[model samples]
Target: MIRSEQKSPFRVYRGATIDRDEIEKLRAGTLVGSNAFFSSSFCEEVAEMFIGTDPLAAVSPCQSPVDRRQFVMFKIDVDLNQTADLIIADVSEQSNFPAEKEILFGLGTTFIIKEITYDIHRNLWYIEMVVSSEMFELKQEYTDFVHGCLKYTDADTLFGTFLSGRSSDYPAGISHLQRHLRKMKFNDPNRANVYFYLACAYRSMGKYEHAIEYFHRAKLLQKGLSSQSSYAYADTLSELAATYSLLNNTAKALSLLKQAVTLFRRILGANHIDMPLYYTRLAYVYWQEKQYEDAHSLLLTALSIFKEDMTSVFAGLSFTKHTMGLVKHALGQREEAISLLKETLEIRRQSYGDDHPDVAQVYYSLALIYADTDDKRIAFQYAQTALNIYQAKLPKHHPSLKRASELVERISSYQRESTLPQSEFHNVQE
Candidate 1:
């Protein structure tokens, strides 16, 4: 039996030999040759899992000398009653191997144990392994020996890290990971998902053109997939609509948002958590089109949904309130609009910190409201605050920066006119 009293520092194939040159290469952290029997994809998958890590410790019922230079081997087995683990594999059955052997050799396949565990219910052993060519060579050097022993970080883990950064409102981190993923060509199976995330990251960074490009890419990919992806396709459509709205393409934005709303209603039912978001998005399109009554009605429905499921939907309530405040202002409910806008601003500030673009948006909105009410001093202050945040946090050419600059300039002009002498003011009025 291949047993170690002390935990094995590294795993190796029993009876396999490595020459001095191969040993030196192994120390250098580079795999020298491909396994002729396995496909390139399979080899790449295995390399991703085991290349930069110490060999996994496993107990194998085979006796062999301790050869530090030997390549690590993983074993594969199949059992009818055992549940499959979540490890990535391209497993296939081979019947020629002995059922009870710890090491199995067949016509063109070798199975070395990767992991073994007992099934409590069925009283059977479950084994996970890799099937590879007999002559496969893995070369590593001194650097490989040190850094290659670290635990593998899979693509899913890296994706989750990017997502976590995005959810925490760190656009720069999301941009960095998006670039890395693109460079790695890492989204083979889930190109839509990767593209969607990249779109969202670009949107958050105020790169609307790039955001629109990626959103369209994601939408196209999602459309090409089977019906199982309908929900995702709909969500992508909704996101694309939002990007269009930001670019002031109101007609296309409204059309896409309506399509998205229909799909969401069909797939998720009326009361699903996504319902409020769809309603709010549709409301935004209406607000953009100056359909105040329609926008107000949709915002009310969205607010009702949010109130019913406050816990699960609390994160979106502030956004709904912000939109509703604008609608209320358009409807001439000035006091109610101010109250809602103030509450939304406070919530955003607490949730995202003072310097976030979302907070800047709220500042700009308040400036508009106060300016309409002839509160020029307060309007100028809020506009200047919004301008500072946009200049600091957004690109120079971003629409939000341009709008804030215009608002600040207009407010400054008004302040200058208001401060003119009575005779000069009368002359200008005349």
Candidate 2:
């Protein structure tokens, strides 16, 4: 924590780092935020990336020598015209190394990547960003929504919201929410909302059993809730259903999803913006149960609504397409399925960048589809890309990494035998 009186700003500090692939995930069009404090510096080495570009670099964490090409430089350009919510400090006069100008930014600031350019001559990559208030506003809006459902709008609420939503720190989010949960009285109106969010955070971290426990707890609190919103209850059911499906409890999953869809349709209307989500989820369950006809019909309904409002549902449309693609594959519409899945791939790359586990998931799905067809070469390519991403983004022992690696090797073995491989892979469940 710094002086509260000091104006708030953001700067990317040196020594703060991610791996090469993780670093590359901050593509030029991406919007990213730091959950920790960062500092920036201006030195001759940093400016050498591009002649016109000002130097920005960081010192080494240890006294060891640093590699030039692999080094990262951060520069923050805050636009005064956009909003006056942030401040920037040159801090050149106060620097320990007076020759190198330094800049400092506040903790938890967001930035929009402007450009990332590589200089061949100097063997360096230069990344420049502009400070943006949009992410902060979005996070705040979500926090406000959470507060409206409960009572507190204090520091813990803000921190927990940031961890749970924007930063995706599920463990920290779980800790904060759980601490908050202990403070709520048994019959408090806010208890249900806290339990609901806690369930979501646990689910995100793949603690399915823990998620189920919280969902059940939240369901019990529903009787005590004073809020008239059926939204939380419906969402809890829908999410719980998905988790159940992942756990292979298809019967329970189907029942819960049906109940969720009924309540969602009644409350938000069949054509509401969020209806497509419920429709698609239910369709996925049907597809998993091998009820292809039912799945197709639900997907078509969701697709029609998805077209009416594509703006707000940008990411949701991709999901609808992806689920339908799986259904189409099951229905033997391979051509259409591949096209739909490819669209999903592109949209996810734009939204989540190239290295996200979700993007790797799409790659794996496409590989499975191609593996079923005569196109073994295309299958190999997709499988290999998925393997590479999974290796980089997932833990060493993650099930996804194991599965992706196996898929790649299996495809290779099929090609080596010069025969059409039997399509024994499971259907796309995500």
Candidate 3:
């Protein structure tokens, strides 16, 4: 029996039901909590938070019922989508879990691991350990490790060095790419694409000035060049707009977004499939400007585009709807905001499954809405849900995690005060 000294980490797996094959896979890994498996609500929460850093962690084997004189610490590696593929080997000594484990990929879905293989000849592990979406929620040590890895691989890590390096040597890992880009010619349109990536990396690192510089460079490189693809111009303008927005220059952001919108409309047409992305950006800027009406109008347009376009872009469209919830709340459309947020939460859960960061976002937003409405009971539930996700998936010091913790504390106080027998203002219902 795997006896846990502490409460085990729990997850809620998504799907109609768990099958025997999946159960066997989970049992091999010493899965702790089955009751917390992902549900519709969990998926919604995960979808909401998918835009930012993944808030996910592994279920610790320490909570398993297996008793052992020697414990094995298996280090698992995950990719950009938060899917962990572990290569487990029996370690001679006990090792504390690494501080970082989750890897956030950028615009890619594959995890191609090379080298460091078992005997350097194994193709892959024979045993398939596919963790259900519901079981991916994590906290504490697991969260810290994942978040740390994310920070290490953040876009800025290389972008910063590239921009800072005046010499030809530049950064270590990306020098090959840089050399390849330079050899292809500086004026090549591909250079602009590289510049955009560099700009994004800078932006991720909060180097707004540098990001804006790279964005301008990308635009210049793209000048007098025409491509069959509209992504180049659209993405360049969007990056410029985002950089300005980050710098708190809302007017510039608005202008840049307008340019992007016009270009997208001209290239892809007004009702093109990608129109939703432009509209979403436009709405985001409007949101930053506190122009609720404009933002709402843009989001509605984007939503209409989504309804018309039946591509995979639907997932992105669903995300935009969730953003609209935040906008509505900002606009003081409390009822509408609450309703929209709830719907968005449901959609995320159904799509992504439970235990995804997007679902946690729903709980986070719901907690805020409930707190604003003074529904302490409901607020407490939402806050607890958010807190659980944050603790499991993000570092303890993360702003969102900290806020959730505070809300939990506040809710607990309220509960304790209201539950006091014969006390004045004891109105909290069990």
Using lDDT as the measure, the top candidate is: 2
lDDT of 2 at 88: 50
What tens digits encode model 3's per-residue C-alpha lDDT throughout 1-430?
1112113322211112222344234334333332332211113233223222123532222222222211121122222134332122222123242221222222212222121211112111112223333333334344665565344233333343344322212233244445555566554545665666666655544456767887888787665555543557676887688677656688998898898889888787898877887787778777777788988998988888888877556456656776788788787787887888788777776665655445766787777777665587898898898788656655445455666777677667767775412111100000
Residue lDDT tens for model 1, 79-142: 3123122112222233242221222232333334445443333222333454333222222232
lDDT-best of 1 and 2: 2
By summed lDDT, which 10 consecutive residues of candidate 2 come out lowest? 60-69
Candidate 2 residues lying further than 4 Å off, grouped into runs, are 1-169, 182-189, 227-229, 391-398, 418-421, 424-430
Reference-based TM-score of each model: 0.58, 0.63, 0.49
| Model 1 ranges with Cα > 4 A deviation | 1-171, 183-187, 224-228, 419-430
Which of 1 and 3 is ahead in lDDT? 1
Candidate with more favorable, higher TM-score: 2 or 3: 2
Task: Give the Cα error of residue 97 in candidate 2, in Å.
Answer: 27
Question: Per-residue lDDT for 207-294 in model 2, tens only?
Answer: 7788899888877756334335467678878878988987778899999999999988887899998898889889888888899899
Instruction: State how far residue 93 of model 3 sits from its true place (Å).
Output: 46
Where is model 3 poorest over a 10-residue stretch in terms of lDDT? 421-430
